[model samples]
Target: MNEVKLIDMLSYLEPELLEDDYIEKDMNKLKNLISKISESSSLITFNKGLRSIIKIITFIIASLLVLVGIIVIIIKKKKPKITKKAFNFVTN
Candidate 1:
């Protein structure tokens, strides 16, 4: 048997991606996806869906902030009442 070193021809762990048809297959899939995305109505629908998702998230975050602000205001108002009573007792 010839003890020839197949340095560039064989890899023990990595698959030979550059020499195979996998790239062509992947490119074809990408091309198909791009073509679908290029259609006017599909593009509009994608944009609309993305915008609605963003709007929904923004609305939820704003509602949460308002809720938290209301809770904080209620707690602060109660604290001032308790402090006022303590001061009145000290004055007497």
Candidate 2:
């Protein structure tokens, strides 16, 4: 019996194994795997986008702060210094 089964099995060994019925049986598993991968990829993309926006916003804010600091320094330097006596006299 074993010899007969082996001989029968060997007869169809050269054919391709990817038939429609085999795929249909595992369709649910394949769909679940695809959905999981798609969700993960979307999450990765969202994270990257969020990071990029945050970096851009940080750079802009830093640039604005530097510009404001430089402007403040320039204005302070342009202003004349008053003596302590003058300050006291003005206050009094």
Q: State each candidate's clash count.
A: 0, 0
Q: Per-residue lDDT tens digits of candidate 2, residues 1-92?
A: 69999989888776565344776768988999999999999999999999999999999999999999999998777655545557878999
Off by over 4 Å in 2: 1-25, 81-92
- lDDT scores for all predictions? 0.86, 0.86
The true-structure Cα RMSD of candidate 2 reads 6.7
Model 2 reaches what TM-score against the true structure?
A: 0.64
- Candidate 1 TM-score versus the reference: 0.47
